[model samples]
Target: MAFECVSRTDVGLRRKVNEDSLLVRTERGLWAVADGMGGHEAGDVASAKVTEALMRLPVVYGLDSMIESAIVALQRVNQELIALAKGNAQRTIGSTVVGLGIMNGRYSCFWAGDSRAYRLRGDQLIQLTRDHSLVQDLVSAGMLDPAEAESHPNANIITRAVGVAEELKVDTVGGDVMPGDQFLLASDGLTRLVEAQELASTLSSNGPAEAADRLIETVLARGAPDNVSIIIAKAT
Candidate 1:
């Protein structure tokens, strides 16, 4: 099986810097999205460093190896960012990350923080990665409504991310890859503004390129308040 991908990033209407970064390597069947914390220093730097590290991954033979390579890469970058922050006298410089790896007719998704991964199969749209944020925690514990979590004042407060702590814990999920399955990796900027059903309709009706364009257009039309980055990959 092979994969095709399309990607896009924008600074949005409110942010001065586009701190989100992404990776799209269809040949390797790997893709990722990283979003630097806006409240942290040099968010752009943190995110850029992450993609750079992932881009250097050597060719691997299987899905397990591919996922392991990605985990090591994130851990290495996590420590690098921690040191960088200490050098700059900052408390933390962090970024949320989500990645997708496909091999041997299967897909594995790994993530930290609130950056997300989703799968569109037929007419059903499933969120593959969950947010590691305060709002998500509250909702999980039944303290906050899922709908209200989006508009919560603490919505942006992620509980985990690269460079935020000495140890980075990445969450992962995997499944058999079916033909025509569509996968999306995106920063919270886009997900926060675009609803899942809308994303499902957009992705189902369009090809990767057009889907990417329409997703960004939707965010922009809503007066995007944060940097947005997205990648759409389809199995063939």
Candidate 2:
């Protein structure tokens, strides 16, 4: 496969801190976004550890292994966070994870929380990750409309996340690669600000780098509510 890539991250207008963290390892053909929760420095530390560990994965592994590796890494990060919290009187660090990797002409993705992954092929945009938030539960239970989910008071209260418990179960998915296919990985910061179609349009033109810029600009225009980070990869 052949393609180009570009990425961008920004601290949005609200929020004094950018708890979002990301990992882009082109050499390893990997990318990830971790939107940390909790207050204080704990969020930053949790997110950073998750990304850092994933960046060091084996040079080559099947989709299943990659998912396994990611889960293991998150478990480790969770333990680290719990230990940190135990040491401090007021520290709760948690985060959402969404990531993708390509190898041998195939692609793999894994996610927990609301950060999303998307595929653009032949003008069609497909969201690959499902939000694990409380709103998603409400929608499934017929308590709310899809649009209202976004504004739900507990919109950010995730059902699954890193460092929230002793163990984590990640949703892993993969697909066969195709030429001219484009992939996107983004944190909830951006996902909450714009719809998926809006993102697809920004990436419809330009290579990854330019696409990344356009995405950031669009979110900022929407009044960025949180730290936003985006990664784009094109397959040839």
Candidate 3:
């Protein structure tokens, strides 16, 4: 199967620079979104490192091999970022990553931090990756309500991220791919402003490019405060 892909990134209304990075290699069936966290310490560099690492990954034959290669590549990038941070007096520089890889008739979703992967199968939209943020932990532990988690003071405090530690742990999930399956990978900037229902509605009504355009437009309409990045892919 071939994929129709579209990706976009914006600095938004408040941020001075865009720290988000994206990768879309249609030939390799690899797509990713990375949202960098450091402000003056070059968050954009951290995100760019992630995409660069992914770009170096060898094209494998099977879904499982591809997933393994992706994990290794991300780990290497994490180490490189750690070394970069050490050279700069250890100021934290990191990024949240969410990636999708397809091979044969299957797809793999992998992530760290709050960047998300959502799959739209037919009329149903499903969030394929779970967030690794403090608010998410609280919500999962039943210590906070789902609706209130968004407004929680620590909502932006992510529990895990690439390049933040000596060893990175990535979460991976896979499933059989079907014709007409639509996948979205996005940073928190877009999700913070657009509701899931709105996303579902917009994606369902348009093709990949239009869907990506509309999503970014929606964020801009809400006076986006952070860098927004998104990638949309449809199997054909």
Candidate 4:
């Protein structure tokens, strides 16, 4: 199967710089989104390092092998960032990553922090990755309402991310891929402002290019306060 992919990034209305990075290698069937931790030193560098590492990953066959390679690559970048931070007086420089890999009719999503992956199969839209933020944990435990999680003052406090600790934990999920299936990888900037129903409808009505354009446009229209990055891939 072949994938038709499109990607875009914006600094948004409030941010002075875009600290989000994306990768779209259609021939390799690999795509990713990385969001730098806001208000941190060299956030753009941290996110760029993530995509740079993923871009260098060796080609591997099978969904399992693809996921493994990505994990290894990310781990290396994690260590690099950690060491760099220590040299700079122990300031944390981190980034959240979400990636999608496809091989032999199957798809895999691997991630850390709050960047997300979603699948649009027919009329159904499913979130494939979960946020590692404190707010997400509270919501999962039923201590906080879902509607309130987004506005919680600690919504930006992520529990895990590359460069945040010596050891990084990345999560993976996968399933069989079908023709006409659509996949989306995005930073929280877009997801925070746009609702899931709107995402599903946009993906269902347009191809990769148009869908990506509309999503970014919607985020900017809603007064984007953070960097936004989006990638859309459709199987054929």
Q: How does model 2 score by TM-score? A: 0.93
User: lDDT by residue for model 2 over 1-236, one digit each (tens)?
Assistant: 55577778888888787788889877667789988874546687778888988887765466667667777887888788777777886556778899897887888888888889999986788988888889998898998999888878888788888877777788888888788899999888878878877777776866777778877888889899789988888886
How far out, in Å, is residue 163 in model 3?
A: 1.3
Candidate 1 residues lying further than 4 Å off, grouped into runs, are none
Q: Give each model a TM-score.
A: 0.98, 0.93, 0.97, 0.98
Tens-place lDDT per residue, model 4, 1-236, is: 88888899999999999999998888989999999999998999999999999999887767798889899999999999999999998689899999999888989999999999999999899999999999999999999999998889998899999999999999999999999999999999999998899999999998889989999999999999999999999988
Root-mean-square deviation of Cα positions for candidate 1 versus the true structure, in angstroms: 0.8
- Write down the lDDT that model 4 would get: 0.93
> Between 1 and 3, whose TM-score is larger?
1
Give the TM-score (vs. native) of candidate 4.
0.98
The reply for model 3, stretches above 4 Å from the true place, is 38-40
Runs in model 2 lying further than 4 Å from the true structure: 38-41
The alpha-carbon deviation from the true structure for residue 40 of candidate 1, after best TM-score superposition, in angstroms, is: 1.1
What lDDT score belongs to each candidate, Candidate 1 first? 0.93, 0.81, 0.90, 0.93
